[model samples]
Target chain A: MSDKLPEKRKIKSAKKMRDIMTTYYLDAMTAKQNNRQVAWITSGGPVEPLVAMDIIPVYPENHGAMIGASKMGEDLCIKAEDMGYSSDLCSYARTDISCSIVKGGPLGGLPEPDMLICCNNICGTVLKWYEIQARYYNVPLFILDTPICHTQYSPEIARYVRTQMDEYIAFLETNTKKKFDYDKMARVGKLAYTAQLLWQKVLNTTAHKPSPMSAFDAFFFLALIVTLRGTQIAVDFYRQLLQEMEQRIQTGISMVPDEKYRLLWDNLPVWYRLKWLSEKFSGHNACLVADTYTSAWCGAIKYTDENNFLDSMAEAYTRIYLNIGVDQMADQVLDMIKFYDADGLVMHSNRSCKPYSFGQMDIMRIVREKTNIPVIMIEADMVDPRSFSQSQIETRIDAFMEIIKQRND
Target chain B: MNNKERGSIYAGIDIGSITAKAALIKDNRLLATHVILTGYDPINAGIKVFEALLKKAKISKKDVPAIVSTGYGRASVSFADKALTEIICHGTGAYFINPEIRGIIDVGGQDSKAILLNAKGQVENFAMNDKCAAGTGRFLEVMAKALEVELNQLGDFGLNADKPLKISSICTVFAESEVISMIAGQQKRENIIAGIHDSAAARVAILANKIKIKKPVMMTGGVAKNKGMVAALEKRLGLTLIVKDFAQENGAIGAAVLASKL
Candidate 1:
């Protein structure tokens, strides 16, 4: 063996991303001193309107992910449970709820929201979570109730959500006491659309022979698309990210060395164990090429109309990955499997997100019947470390990889 | 002989949560096996079990050419040539015993799994119980303690029940409390034991159904020795299970077989 150490394959853009996130949080933290209105919004909620209205949009779900990554999820989750919130509630809701009172987390809790925007396109837990926060902060809460489109997006459902879009704009105008800028919204919508397209390209770069980046990196780089969407900053950053991915592919730099097997992930990441899980997979020469979670940000881009921004926001927000039927979701998973050329599938049966975890068994069955690859489901919580069992998960992953190796050999 | 002269002998050590087992194989034939309580030190247990197995086989440690370690404490065996998970080892062990076994339901001390095997005895698919002890061997041990009965006696006692009571809780702690209430209500011990077996069988059945396990399934692991649990699982799954000798040491045997290849 050579005496020299192996070269580290760290992504150079990570530093810039971290710096941008730090500045973003700093801006949110001092929003009051800077005389900027901050609207706390859901991860799946529409943020172009907020950007058009010159309101800084904040995401508590992102904060929950940050808390989970910081390994402070257990204390906040326990605090919420102590406060009589059921342990069964979503971890994001629990962490954000407790964080509001305790002012905990990486940035000492998010800036006090001038308004709260909740869109239940992802899960029903957000309604009550935002309600609790609205009552605590004594702010006006705007709820965009997008009914579930099980089979298809019906015309009546579109009309219902479209009317709510008008009401949403009216609520924003009333809270911020400023006129909604349609011209700026047009520009923001186009930028948002471009950012999503660029994000999809960044994800697609992994479809190469050896993935330039894995889903773990996507989970980290995803903060910008979710937090800074509908802004020139997000568009420019993703453009650079996509270029970096292409460059990495050209130089033959893959995330997992000797990537022998490629796997696709499902549901939210176990944030607290991101590094551990990544290392574990890379140790086995398996790269998680793509995931259903990060791609959900760009998955709904097909429904958007760049020119008529407000006209198509209803359908674009309503027909997300979580809002659609299980069969449709299975089809998307199958497509991802083929597109990424996955050797197997690893599904995280998250305990916190009910909607995401509810139909995973059926999806597992569907994937098994439709493909020859092996599939494994790991029970875990995205944010709550209490639900995680490290040794057991380690064994399962090892066994799963062994099966894959057996099949290929 | 020194190590190189007798290279045909291979060894496997399985360091489980409650017990450590070791097996020796020579030229694809079973040589000897030994089992002992793991206690608090798995690494030491692995060494002790291997030494005892070598003694039982009337051979020296130097005769074994390769060693593969398995089970929950697989990584603890620093001397192993390699470490593998119990899932693949169990499937291999069952297939080695009876190549006709298309599926295996292994209920070990802490976890239970249902594995589907292909024609060549390779694991095709598998499903394991979540991070709970509801359907595992530990669940039965806990119930046996509550009933003041020996762990080995639960199978026979459960067989005598005329009407098995229904157990509603899937959580081990809650199920224990439920058992306490039944005892308070003067329920029969055999009936309660039967109920616990059925509840645990029900949980294991989900794993079987998840993988869509085929017929000719083998029951392995320490819990396979319990005839009552096997019968309950058979009834729940609408199929019989094949339980052969050395069911508990199947993982170690499989590991030994793999070590020979290594």
Candidate 2:
């Protein structure tokens, strides 16, 4: 271990990202004062229409990540359970619901919404979650139902989603009391597409030996793309981030101080334990080069056409990483393993995110059969730290690393 | 152990959830092994086991150059040169005992686990019950108390059953209540014990099947001494399991083996 700091590993773009996020949150929080309508949106909801209508798009899921990372998830989750919500419900929904009532989160709580946008592209849980919020806030709710694309995206499904996209715009018009601006939407769509592309390029930089960044870093940098995806700020920030990652690649600076083994992470991160998990892997000289969660922002790149932004988004948003079959999900995981040359797979098996964690066993089996690489499943919640057991997870990680080392040796 | 190399000794102490074990190794050979009740204090159990083993081996603490501690209380051994998890220690110990062994099924005090070993005697993969005591010694102890029988006499009683009752619950608390209800219903004690073993074996088998555990497997840990458990697990897995004489001290022996590297 060297005493000197690793120069390129210190991501300079992180400060700017934080500043941008703080500004975005402040803007959302003070939307009422600014006479700007706020629309609470799901992570997988179409935010471009909100951007086009000048309605501030606030994501509870993103706020849930903040709550989890801040280590306030356990309390918020308990509050929701006390309020009669089942513990089995998604932690994001639980935390967000409780935080709305108690004003308990990193940001005190998300801005109260005048309208709610529910997208089932991610999961069915959001539909109920948003309905609960809409009733509580006395707001109109719009649901964009994107049927699961088990294998392929059919024209009928595409037509159904596209028609809803129009209804989505109409819903925005009704709530915001503003006309639909196609010109601004086209621009926002292009920016969103470019941001996604840059995010992909940033993630792809890990393909280089001794990865310049890790999935931990990706989890942090993912905020802009998730919240303010259609804005020029996100595009600018990602472009800068991409350049820094490329520089780190050229300079041969790795995130893991002594990178020997590279692993791919599946599902959402154990949010509160990010630093501990990062250090644990780093201690073993294993770098989590990629994860399915962070890469999800750009996972459906092939479906988008910047020219046909609105129309193409119908396909792109519908065919996200979580909106597919297990076999297809496994195929994506296999492709990631090959792309990053990962030595093993670490699946979180998150208790909170059912859509992401449900078919993980099948994916693990597929990865093992195809690659013959060791796969470990860690049972935990994305937000709730109560579900995490340090010693149990530590043993699994240590034993997993030993196997990788043995095979490598 | 080579008599000439008795001066160079290594110690491994495993303070598990229910028992503490210590093994002394000299010249790549196990010199002596000791096991005692872990009781309440894991830190004291680690120290007491090491001292007891030293006395049993007729060796001073100064004779051992390195000491490695393992098990749930591995970190409690403040005097050890290093602390390693039970998973690695078990793999190393099982391999040291029989290099031919390709898989390991360890059912400890509070948890059960399955480990797959490669040809090089390294852990290929492993799985354990996540913070559950369904298929562990604790579960058996509770069942023993419920049946008003001695824990050691459980194996013999289970073996004598003509028709084992079915225990459906995967939870120790629920299973114990089920056993109590069975007793009230005038069910035979041996049949209930056999049912308990069957349920435990089912849980352990799930972990083993998940990793696709290889054959030529060996059973380790304190519960391995229970003939009924060994029989039930073998039946569930549909494969023969090799239970060593020093199964209880396997983790401690593996820790000692690991200490040799230090």
Q: Score the docking of each candidate (DockQ).
A: 0.87, 0.68
Model 1 Cα shift for residue B160 (angstroms): 2.6
Looking at model 1, residue B42 earns an lDDT score of 95
**TM-scores for every predicted model:** 0.97, 0.96
Candidate 1 per-residue lDDT over residues B1-262, each given as its tens digit: 2333344898888999988999988767788889899999999999999999888888887788789999999999999999999998998888888999999999999999999999999999988888899999999999999999999999999999999999999999999999999999999999999999999999999999988899899999999999999999999999989999899999999999888877
Candidate maximizing DockQ: 1
- For model 2, how does the per-residue alpha-carbon lDDT over B1-262 read when each residue is reduced to its tens digit? 3324545888899989899999988888889999999999998998899989999999899888889999988889999998888888999999999999999999999788999888878887789998788999999999999999999999999999999999999889899899999999999999999999999999999999988999899999999999999999999999999999899999999999888876
lDDT of each: 0.93, 0.92
Off by over 4 Å in 1: A1-7, B1-7, B184-186
Off by over 4 Å in 2: A1-8, B1-7
For TM-score, the strongest prediction is: 1
Two-chain DockQ for model 2: 0.68
RMSD in Å for model 1: 2.1
